[model samples]
Target: MNLSIDVTNNEGVSNVVLTGEVDAFTAPKLKDTLLPLTKEKGQVVEVDFQDVNYMDSTGLGVFISALKSTKEHASTMRLVHMQDRVYRLFKITGLTEIINIESTVQGGM
Candidate 1:
């Protein structure tokens, strides 16, 4: 399963929607897609993972790196509409506490 990222600008925020498998072989693509967005100062970025079917540690690493980059630029990064499996992974790994994860679009931070 190939990973794909679609980026769009909404108001002043950047919405990055990710789909397909994000594993060792495909996590780099996700990272590359998000790197530039995080470089800009005060840019709000939200990564929607509602359509993502699978992910691994590499994928989680990519998300963490992106979050760090956003912080360095004084921008905010969030994860929205995560699937149950993905949400569980975040919980077990303590990532849910470190990064904001929304259960639904209406509940985003």
Candidate 2:
């Protein structure tokens, strides 16, 4: 299925809710939605992956680029509520070591 992204801003944080598969086809859409947020200094961009069932290497690359962009802007990017399969992808790729991931909503909120 195609990917869907929902974005909401709360205070200074941007909450991005992602659903469906994130592959090469949909990864660009994710980047377009997120890359701009990373340009806003002091902005906190939170990606909630609770509904995302699949993500490929392309999607992972998008997140890595966003992480770099956010850091350059002195902002932060958080990955939240990742499914077990998706989380394992990050773990295996060693992205978990570089990216900020919050398993609990409390930490994200």
* Number of the predicted model whose lDDT against the real structure is largest: 2
| Candidate 1 residue pairs that clash | none
- Per-residue lDDT for 1-109 in model 2, tens only? 6999999998889999998999999999999999999899999999999999899999999999999998899999999998878888899999899999965444445
Residue 7, model 2, lDDT: 96
The true-structure Cα RMSD of candidate 1 reads 3.5
**RMSD per model, one decimal:** 3.5, 3.6
Per-candidate TM equals 0.90, 0.92
* Candidate 1 structure, TM-score to reference: 0.90
Off by over 4 Å in 1: 104-109
- The 0-to-1 C-alpha lDDT of every candidate, in the order given, reads 0.86, 0.91
Model 1 weakest 10-residue run by lDDT: 100-109
User: What digit string (tens of lDDT, one per residue) describes model 1 on residues 1-109?
Assistant: 7988899997769999988888999988888888889888888899888898788898999988988898888888888988877787888999999898986544345
